[model samples]
Target: MNPKWLTRAGLCALLAIISLAASAAPAGPPRVAVTDLAYEERVSEYFRVVSASSKSSLRASGRESERDSDDAYSRRSSGSLNARSESNYSSTEGTYSYIDRGEMRKFTADIKGGLIKSGRFELVQGKPFTDTKHTEKLYDIIARIKQGMYPGADYVLFGSINSIEFRQEANPIDHTNTVSHTLSLELVGEFSLINTRNYAIKSSFSAMGTGQDVKLLTSQGGRVVLNRGKVVSEVSRSLGEDVARQVEEQLTGVSSAEERDNSYRPRGESVREEVIIFK
Candidate 1:
C-alpha cells in the first residue's frame, strides 16, 4: 500500500468526474421554431330546426256580393270556424367565432416552457408566430432563424389544423330542446431536425391528432355558441403533449422509427360527432 500513489489516483479521479459533468451539462433547451398554429373555419351541413306553438290573433279580409243572396230563405246559421294558422317565421343564428390568437400563442409558449422545466430539452424562446391567418410555410421558419430570432436552433416544430367542426341535433319531440354541439379538432404536426452547421433537415417526422373532441355546448337559437378559444387551448395542450411524446419516442428509439418514406401517417381516427344532449 502506497499512500502517495493513492492520493495521486484520487486527484485524477476527481478531474475525470469534473470533465464528465461538464460534458453532460446541457447548453440549453433545443431551439424550436413553432409555426403559428393555423386553424380552419369549418361549417357543418347538418342543421336543426325548432318550432314553437303559441296562441296569437290573426286578421282576415273578405269580399261579398249582396245580389247573390236574393233568393235567400232568410235563415242564417250562426257558427264559428276554426282554422289552422301560421305566422311569419323568424329565426336567429348563432355560432362560436375564433377567439383571440393570443390564447393559442400563449398556449404554445407555455408548452415549450413546460418541456424546458421538465429538463427534457433546452428550449430556446423565439418570436411567436403572429401570422395566424395563412398557410404555414418552411420559409417562415428559415426566415426567422436567418433573422437571428433563433440563432442556433437544433430543430423546428410546426402544426396546422386540418379541420374543426361542431355539430348539433335537436330532439324531434321537444321543439325547444337543447342540442349537443361537439367540437372536433384535427391537428397535424411536423418536426425537422437541423444540423446547426448547415441548417439542413437531418431528420424529420410528422404526426396527426384526429377526432379530438375539445369541448361541447348546447345550441342556442339556431347556432352553437361555445368558447372556441377554450377548445383550441385544450386541443393545443393535448396536441403539444402528444407531439412531444412522439418526438421523444423517436429520439429515444422507443417506438418504431417513423417511416421516412411515408413521411406522414394517420394519427388517429376521425372524431365522430358526439351528441351531448338529446334535446
Candidate 2:
C-alpha cells in the first residue's frame, strides 16, 4: 500500500472511532438547581357553633252530669297547661399563624438534599433564590441559570408554599377516659421545573403533606408532647422524594431504575398528596 493511502486510512479509522464513542456513551444528566422556597404566613380564623333544645307539656279535662230532678246536680272540671323550652348555644372562634418564611426555607433545603440523594438526577447545590417581590420572576430564574449563577444549571426547580394550616384538638385515646390531643401542620406547595436552554417547563406539580405531634394527657396529669419538628422534617423529606421520582418519570418516560430503600419512614397520616404533570 502507498504511504499516502495508509495516512488516509489512519485518519478515517480515527474519525470512525470518535463517532462510535460519542454514539455509545449515554447523554449526561441535566444540570439542576433548587431555588429558594417561599411562603407567606397569613392570619387564619375559624368559627363553630353548637346548639340543643327540648320541651314537653301535658293537660287533662273531664265533665260529669247527674240527673235526678230538674237540673238537680252537675259537675264539670277543666285544666290549663303550658310548656316552655330553653336552648343553649356554644360558639368558638380561633386565630392562629401559619409556617413563616424561614421555616419554609428550611423545608426547601431539605428537599433539595433529598433529591440529590435519590440518585435520580444531578442537582447543583447553591444558595436558594427567594422571591421577595409580588411580581413573577420565573423568567428571571431561568436567566440566572443561563448565566451560570447556579454553576452550570440547565434546569431549575422552584416552589412556593401555597398555604399552611395548623389545627389543635382533643380526642379520646384507646377507649379510655384519658384525653389526647394533636397539633397538626398541613402544607400545600406548588413546584415547577424549567429548562434553562429553551425556557420550557419540563414539569409542574402540586404536593401536600401533614405533620402532627401528639400529646397524651393521662388522668394522673402526666403529659408528653411529641416533637413537632420531627414530623415536619419527615414530611418534607417524603415530599422531596416524591418530587424526584416525578421528575425522573417525566423526563425519561419511565420510573427510576434505582430502588428507594429507606428503611425508616412515616405513615403519611392524614396527609393529602397530589401531583399533576404538564409537559
Candidate 3:
C-alpha cells in the first residue's frame, strides 16, 4: 500500500488504455452505402427460329412398239421392237420463322438480380430513372440522402444504361442449303460514385461488353431454342463482378477481401480524400 507503488499501477493502467485506443482505431475500409440498384432497361436482343418441311411425290409411265418385215429377191426386209419408260419423283419444301419477346424480360431481370447478390454493399432501392435528360431524379436522390434515409453512408452509387443493343440476322445460302442465325447482346455500363457527405462525385467508371454472338442452324426440321435469361445472367454477373472489383480497388486500394482487411494506412496518408472532381 505504499504511495509509490500506487503511482506505478496508475501509470500502467493509462498505458493499457492508450494501447487499446490505438488498436481500435479504424485502419481502412470506409463504411459505404450503395444506393440506386435498380434495373435499367438496356439493349437486350433475343431471337429464335423454327423450321418445318413438307413433301410430295409424282410418277409417269409410257410404252412404244414397232414392226417391220423383209423378203428375198427383189423384196424388202422387216423387224419388230418394243420399249417402255417410267418416272417416279418426290419433292420437299421447308419454312423458317422466329419469335423474340420473352427473352428480353428474362435478361433484364437476370442482370438486376445478379448485381444485388454480389454482396458489395447495402443495396437500396429508389424510384426508377431513365438515362435521358432527367435531373429531377438526381435531385430527389440527393434530398433523400439529406433526410436521413441513409445514415452513416459515405458514398452514393449511380449508374446508367448507355446502350443496350441486340443485332439479329439470318442468311440462307441457296447452294449450301443452310441457314445461319446470329444473335448478339451488347451492353454498356456507366457508373459513378458520389460522396454522401458533400454530395460530390467520388469516382466514375464505365465498362462495355459487346460482340457476344450465338450462332445456330435452322435447317434440320427443328427449332433452335435459346434461353435469354441465361445469356443475360452471365453478362450481368460478369459486369457486376468487374464493377464491384473496381469500386473496391478505388475505395480501398485493394481488390480482394483479405487485402482490404489487412490494409494499413500508407506511410504518409492520414486521411483518405474523395477523388471525384466535378467539372
* C-alpha lDDT of all candidate models, in order: 0.53, 0.68, 0.57
Question: Residue by residue across 50-161, what tens digits does model 2's lDDT show?
Answer: 6666555555455555556675765555556565555565666666664334324556656666666555557787555454552344335665575566767777887777
lDDT of 3 by residue, 117-161 (tens): 443444444333343454334435577677776676666665556
- All candidates: TM-score: 0.45, 0.60, 0.48
How would you encode candidate 1's per-residue C-alpha lDDT over 1-279 as one tens digit per residue? 899999999999999999999999967545565545544443445444666665566555554433336566344334454555555555555554444332134336544643554344656555564554643432355665666656545765545444344443333335644544555555565555554456676446665543423233345455445555665666567666666666666665555445421332223434457778766
Regions of model 2 farther than 4 Å from truth: 41-103, 130-139, 173-175, 252-279
So what's the TM-score on candidate 1? 0.45
Task: Enumerate residue pairs that collide in model 2.
Answer: 36-129
Per-residue error for 272 in candidate 1, Å, reads 42
Off by over 4 Å in 1: 1-33, 38-107, 110-114, 128-140, 160-179, 209-225, 256-279
lDDT at 224, model 1: 49
Worst 10 residues of 2 by lDDT: 260-269
Model 1 weakest lDDT span, ten residues long? 260-269
Which numbered prediction scores highest in TM-score against the true structure? 2
Would you list the clashing residue pairs of candidate 3?
43-164, 68-78, 68-79, 69-77, 69-78, 70-77, 70-78
